[model samples]
Target: MPLPYSEKVMEHFRQPRNVGRIEDADAKSIEGSPACGDMVAVYLKVDRESLRIDDIKFESYGCASNIATGSIITELAKGKTLEEAKHITWKQASEALGGLPPIKTHCSILAVDGLRAAIENYEERHGLIREHKPTTIEVIRKRLKRVMNPMVGLDLVRTKVVKDIEIADGVVRVAIDLPADHQFAANIREEISEKIQPLWDVQKIVVEFTE
Candidate 1:
């Protein structure tokens, strides 16, 4: 069978742009994990006056799709203002690359996530982020959608693996429908914490397995 990837995907994978770290970056983020066999790191240098991304780069540890997505995402975010870059989506990244396989769609998601996280970090550092809003279960669930299940290369929320979510008094509890000893259980838990821990109002996080 022919390769499933498009020509754009192959080209980017072969010579991914911005494939290193920016040691004095204005902001940076690293997402994904070795357990998933995929990780992406993003760094940015923003023009504080214009709030534009003066420079952007990425380092990816994963498949061809992962590297390609990272390359395309940085190209899309560079020269854009923080507000504009925040709107860059995984679909846009995949489309820019001509498209990715259905099974590898999460690669785009991971790449876009790294970009957004870096932007958020910059905003937080420069006091551009808005004041804290009340945390809700719905918000928590929405964020959980970004936590992919390594076994399936799909998010836990989309796969219906997030059995329950509860929040009260600054504490958030999440119940995942996986065996406690499952190979990716710890990785999933860590991803869940990373997603929720950023909330200003979330003082604690508790993840439990419900197998």
Candidate 2:
């Protein structure tokens, strides 16, 4: 890979901005694209009174372009009002990176999506915005727990132990620690896909065996 980005992108990747956690973040959001193996978690400290982003931090797992996108997004969001931050787009991130290659455009889009999701979570939790429905993750997790619990014979699987569950652009990706060659692995994958596909237009399901 001869670097799928311009010099600016490399610079940001090498010296990423806000590359850590916010100790007392008001809101945190994580998004991942299993197709591209990219994951980003964004934490924000919002000034509730002003409804502005007071501080921001990001931790990402992926390629250089993705890291650069995350770094640029955090810098762009800091000090901006929630409304302003919502308008931050992939074009702005790509421009900041001096432009990414056509193939890597989704990387920038992913970062933009993650930022928007974090802000949305913040607004919803603080009553800054009202919605008639809960988030898809909440709804799907509930359904999965209800429907799949009987099949798995477990009360609840630790969400943290899941390691990775990401939804983006109508696609959901889950990585679990099950044995690859286990007799029931295929059945489990099928069961999950069958359960969740009806709830969402799941594009992919990746099962990683930890043991």
Evaluated with TM-score, which candidate comes out highest?
1
* Candidate 2 per-residue C-alpha lDDT over 62-175 given as tens digits, one digit per residue, 9 for 90 to 100: 888889999999999999999999999889888978899876655566677778878977976787665445236666564344222222333125333244567777677666
Off by over 4 Å in 2: 1-3, 33-36, 131-211
Off by over 4 Å in 1: none
Residue 207 of model 1, lDDT score? 95
Candidate 2 has its poorest 10 consecutive residues by lDDT at 147-156
Give a tens-digit lDDT track for model 1, residues 58-129.
999999999999999999998999999999988889899998999887776788899999998888777786
TM-score of each: 0.94, 0.63
Winning model by lDDT: 1
Candidate 2 at 71: error in angstroms?
Answer: 0.5
**Full-model lDDT for every candidate:** 0.90, 0.71
